[model samples]
Target: MIIEIKVPSPGESITEVEIGSWLVEDGAVVAKDQEIAEVESDKATLTIVASEGGKIEIKAEEGEAVEVGAVVCTIDTSVEAPAAPAEPKEKEEAPEEEKEKPEAKAAEEKKSVPESSEHDKVKVTSVAKEMMKEHDLSLDDVINGLKRLGKKEVEAVVNAPQATAAAIPQKEATRDEERQRMSSLRRKLSARLISVKNETAMLTTFNEIDMSYVMDMRKKYQQKFVDIHGFKVGFMSFFTKAVATAMDFHPMVNAQIDGEEIVMPQFVDVGIAVSTPKGLMVPIVRNAESKSIPAIELEIKELAEKARNKKITVEELQGGTFTITNGGVFGSLLSTPILNPPQSGILGMHNIVERPVAVNGQVVIRPMMYVALSYDHRIIDGKDSVGFLVKLKELLENPERLFTGGKDAGELMLGI
Candidate 1:
């Protein structure tokens, strides 16, 4: 029986997809549930698997766009698999010819001699001449030395590209240009970015946080935290926890504008913007307000890995109340991150640099990171945006609140 393999829906709004690449060749035998092709949609790339074990017949070529539910290939389950071919048997009567192979191979590998006119004045030794003759080498193969020619020198010259490459001057290659079609995800990203700019009243507010506390905390308790949680404590966890807590005080930043109504969420679901090879994917951490720092760190790490490997699901990419993107990993000093559609706010974290600052009226060098919050002005006012960042700054600058509601760090660290 032949079964048709149709393109599966990648996401809610996705209707068509371009065949990214066929994992199996036409007429190739594939096992059930084996990936046969990757379908690229506007949102994500999905793998199409063989429904049952069979010989596959590709109906759609790679790079061709096919609508959802359209047949991409057919599997012929009725045909039996072909038998493996037998290996060749070794011959037994080749000892004599094998002995002469070394001499023949040496002759083939020997380099060509220079013109006789070039080395006529150079004296050739009898032993060197015989050795060169046996190896099909020449006088040019011998390097000039204070002593007589040697067999080793002749062998080195023969191994050098036979002097053919050295004899000719090669031309330098010119730069060439090649073009490829835009991926559905990239195209969609471009359109959505433009739509976001035109449709929303976006405003950016910036603040600087002293990272000394977090750095010191991580340095002192990182090993202990890892010993208990199996993962190191990171700055993102602190920032995520801070954002979740700050949202309660500034609920407007955690709200989105739907049509004419402003929808405020009861729980904090923070989206982490992960940069993947395919494109940027934002996967949400649901109920981040309730999750522990170690739990948030583990979930973020897993989600980021899945996004990078193209293993993230459509459900994972949906419904984020707010987003947090760290351009710091790529050394971005400062950047105003754009909104991830419908969401009212996004926070951008940048690289930390040591700079001289006034602490208690004294100049001191401290690690500082610039943070920016871009929010929709439609529902969030300028005061709310600035206040939200200020609150985040206070929490991150003194991050002990994350572990204890403002208690001693030693007690909390010991408890963990």
Candidate 2:
């Protein structure tokens, strides 16, 4: 029986996809449920697997754009895949005489020509020694093979400056160019970036935070956290927690304009921007406001691993109310991040640097990081944007405030 393998739809509204690559060669035997090819759609890269064990005949070539549900290959189920070869067993030991013959021959050769102390000091690499042994040549035989230098040879070495210069390696320059067709994912990304810049009234607000408190907290409790959770926590989790807590005071930052109506979500779903080989992918952490730091860290790690391995689904990449991108991983000191459309706000984190700043009327150096919030002005005003960042700064600078609903411990205890 012959079974046709068709391309699977990656997501809704996507009609076509480019064949990213063929994992197996054409006409090769494939086992049931084995992945044979990868298809690149505008949203994500998906794999095509075999339904039954059989020989596969590829119909669509790689890099060709095929419509969804089109047949990309067919399987001949009658022809089974060849079984893997069995491992060989160890051989019986050789006769003692056979081994002694080689040892005796080596001893005879060593006695024939005893090397000088100076010659014994010369190191022979394992590879060179193996080659000499294979050729039945000893160290003396190799030394004697060298030709003696004569007067003519000495004169040639002294007089030939140009020849010596030519012997040195030099880099040759070439003007070579190569072009490749853009995949569906890259083309879609290009279109979306251009649309974001043209459609929204985006504005960015910047602020600096003293990271001494967060760093000290991590240093103090990191081991305890890891021992209990089995994974280390990172700054992204702290920033994500801070962003979620600050949303309570500045809910407008999480609101988006839906046509004539402004849709404000009651819950916070923070998207963490992860850079992968295919492109930038944002995987949403659902209900971040209700989760603890350890829980958030583990989820982010799992989602990022899936995204980079091309195993992420379209549903995992959608329905994010706000996004947080850390350019600090790439050593970005500061950058105004572009807004992810439909969502009104995105935060950018930068690398930390030690600089002098006034603290209680005294000059001191502290670890500081610059944070930027880029929001759509159509739905978010300057007052909300600036206040959102201030709230985020307060939460981060006093990380304990995150546990107390973005308020000081004293204020919370005093009922102020």
In the range 269-386, model 1's lDDT, one tens digit per residue, is 9999988777888989999999988999999999988888777788888899999999999999999999999899999999999999999999999999999999989899998999
Root-mean-square deviation of every model: 9.7, 8.0
Give the C-alpha lDDT of model 1. 0.86
Which residue pairs in candidate 2 have backbone atoms (N, alpha carbon, C) closer than 3 angstroms, thus clashing?
none
Listed in order, each prediction's TM-score against the native is 0.73, 0.79
lDDT score, residue 101, model 2? 75
Q: Candidate 1, clashing residue pairs?
A: none
Model 2, 1-416: lDDT tens digits are 99999998777878999999999999899999999998998888888899999999999998999999999999999999889899898897888766667788777666443443548854567777777766767777777886886899679767865556778899998899899777778888899889999999999999999999999999999999989999898999999999999999999999999889999999999999999888888999999999999899999999999999888888888889999999999999999999888899999999999999999999999999999999999999999999999999999988989899898999878999
Candidate 1 TM-score, true structure as reference: 0.73
Q: Using TM-score as the measure, which candidate wins?
A: 2
